[model samples]
Target: MKKVITLTLPGELIFTRLAAQTAASVAALVCGECHPKDNNCEFINAFELAVSEAFTNSALHACQDELPPVTLTFIAERHQLTVTVRDTNEPFGIETPQPDIESYPEGGYGLLIIRKVMDTVTYRRDGDANIISMSKKL
Candidate 1:
């Protein structure tokens, strides 16, 4: 069976923090729903981190100046967790940072972290919206 939760977040600081809080909540639910015996410490932490980074990126980059609302959707199934964050803003092209800069960089590292944590990071452009889909196996 699959469980889904969708949340609409305002393009504001308070709502931004709420997004991270929401990610943690979902992680807890998934950990309990999937494997109560094992809390999935590592995977749970990674999911929380990646979700926070991705949401922050969308609220900051994609919705820049426009203050467009961001939609965060969490889907948990038998053995996988899929987080879909969509924003009705221009898609900002992102490229992996250079190997040298990737190490000691203070910025432009969110996508790198997302790639490392999530099993798959997919991007789709729908008209003027950018949809970022991140998945991790439970």
Candidate 2:
């Protein structure tokens, strides 16, 4: 079976939590059973973190000067779950370098963390949209 959830939210930091919660619910409904042995809800946590980070990036930086809404999609398949975050930002590089850990920086690690947790991540530009697609195996 296949299922999908989509949300178009205001481009603001405060809305990140809504996206995170939605992602968590979809992950749990789609593949929570895969983590029966995990007591800390690792499966759900990963999705929440990834979605939150992706949405935050778009909210915090995508608009440049104007506020354009952001789009998120969650696709659940038999063996994996894919989340896609889309925005109206100009095309940017997805190969983000790891932040200087020694400096104890507070930011610049969103993409890296997403890469670490999700099994697949892809970026594409479709006309005026910047699409970030991420997925994890179930």
Which structure among the candidates has the greatest lDDT? 2
lDDT of each: 0.77, 0.87
True-structure RMSD, every candidate: 3.1, 2.6
Q: Candidate 2, clashing residue pairs?
A: none
The estimated TM-scores of all candidates read 0.83, 0.90
lDDT by residue (tens digit), candidate 2, 1-138: 888889999888999999998888888888757443344677688889999999998888865566799999988999899999999976888887899999999988998899999999999999999999999987
Kindly provide the TM-score of model 1 when superposed on the true structure, using C-alpha atoms: 0.83
Q: Write the per-residue lDDT of candidate 1 for residues 50-95, one digit (tens) a residue.
A: 8788778876765456688889999998788888888887676656
Clash-forming residue pairs, model 1? none
Residue 119 in candidate 2, Cα distance off native in Å: 0.3
